[model samples]
Target: MTIRVLIVDDSKTMQAVLRARLSREADIEVVATAGNAAEARQLMRELDPDVVTLDIEMPGMNGLDFLEKIMRLRPTPVIVVSSAAQAGTESAARALALGAVDCYAKADRFGAMGTEDNGKLASLIRQAAQIRFDQRAPSIPKVSVKTQKSIGGDTRLIAIGSSTGGVEALQILLRDFPADCPPTMIVQHINVNFAAAVARRLDSICKAKVLLAEPDMPIRRGQVYFAPGGDRHMMLGGTENWFVKLRQGDLVSGHRPSVDALFRSIAPKIRGHVVGVLMTGMGSDGARGLLEMAQAGATTIAQNEASCTVFGMPRAAIELGAAGVVAPLDRIAEHALSRAA
Candidate 1:
């Protein structure tokens, strides 16, 4: 099915560029474009597009305000467009909290690398379009490396990868963790610019300290590190003394700070000392990596579909025979802790 999309941004240039970019897709169609909430509201009613790419810094009613109204009334899948700025970061956070499916970050001047930028934009548009309209917030609801023996003795490291419904899932999973929980790290697919915001948000609610992963940062027990979501992958080193090393380069498993990168990194370094969890997401980014972790003697789990907002990632892992156990979102924490400790 062709995915119909509406573009809502104050800038005509951005609108034109987005239009040209989205036009590159064979399945995504630009149903309409609007400059303000008023126009967008009208177009939304008339066009009934499957998805909407909304700019948070709009003229009249801001994107957050309109997003609230849309969620309450229209309920279309909305991906927010934000600038690569501090304000944009905050706004993107607010947009996500308000139920925006995802966010897109644009450089200050949108045309520095027009063609390349558009290609990225085209990918976002296509992904945004694939989100099913029935997908809703439930309020906190890989690798072919090997098959290892059931080596169990207190999990030393825990790594998780998620997307789509990850923020809420992480919140639910981490809230109950005691201060002495195993050193943990997560790669949640989100806008690169908003990674810090998410870390801060999670820090406020988690019993464990949640901080953004830094280069050469030591992995400490009871503290959770989040992968910075931009151009780098978070890697693990050191067998006895664990540390995080952020590497900037190509996207691994289709993401920087990818779950696969984090998982596979730890596999060879610390056998039987890790537990990997692949949760809700839209693709197969972490499947093979999780397999590597499991085969290296680490316990691995995939969140079950019943509790997942989107079952893509977990499903993929299960399909690849990667997960040692499949569990519901709520039960995952308990299962991990039991296996880890």
Candidate 2:
């Protein structure tokens, strides 16, 4: 099916450029373009496009405000198209929390992104088009610190992998963690520019202290580490004393900081002492590695399809027989904590 899209940007040039770029895709059709929220709102009501590509910066009503209105009122799938500056700001993180499927960072001022970037955007648009907001699970009550079971001494580490809807998923999962949760590491596929902003956002909502992982940083309880998005892959390192190790490498499983790399790195070293979670994402990056982790006797979990924003990664893992437990998004944290306990 052709994916119908609405482009909402203040600049006519950007709208034209996006139109031209997307026109190259055979299965995507730009149904309409809107200069601002007012135009977009009206066009949305009439056209009812399958997806909306939105810009964060707009004149009358900002893209974020408009996005909030859309999600609250209409619930169409939205993807935020942001400049470099906007991508690095908290506004980008807020866009994800507000229900945008993904954030596409513009390459330059004129929106002259390369062919590969355009293809990525096309793929994202296709995924976003498939989203059904009505299928979303109800919010889960967070397990209070006082009620959580004591962390078993045998469970020393927790590692998580996510992409696509991960910014929101991570926030929800981490909110259930106690202040003194186990040593945890996360690899969420994201733009390098938005990594720090996402970390700050997660830090604010979570009870555990979240930090961008650094080379040789020792993993410790009560602290959560995120692989800072860039050229290097974050690995669980050291023989006896586990620490973060960043290694330069080509893209593995179509990602530089690949989830497979992180999961495979820890599988042999930590064995049953670790809990590995593969959450919502678009590809099979973590499937094989998750299988290896399960083979190494680690407790493994995957987010259930019904609750996933995009069920690709977890579906792949489940098919590979890697996930020992497949739980809904809201119950994932509870299962992880229970297995650890």
TM-score of each: 0.84, 0.92
lDDT of 1 by residue, 1-341 (tens): 88889999999988887787777778888889999999999999899998899999888898899999997888777888888777668778767766677877766344252534636666665666666546544434210111112212366888999987677678777876666778898999987779898788788877779999899899888889998877888888777788988888888877776888888898888754678999988889999999888788888999988777678899999999999999877667766777432
- Give per-residue CA lDDT, model 2, range 41-140, as digits (tens): 9999999999999998999999999999998899888999887674446888889877788888866545555544537788889889888877866455
Highest TM-score scorer: 2
Error of 2 at 329 (Å): 1.6
Candidate 1 regions exceeding 4 Å error are 24-26, 59-61, 72-74, 108-116, 133-154, 271-273
- Please, what is the whole-model Cα lDDT of each candidate in the order they appear? 0.79, 0.86
Error of 1 at 130 (Å): 1.9
Q: In lDDT terms, how accurate is model 2? A: 0.86
Off by over 4 Å in 2: 86-88, 109-118, 144-147
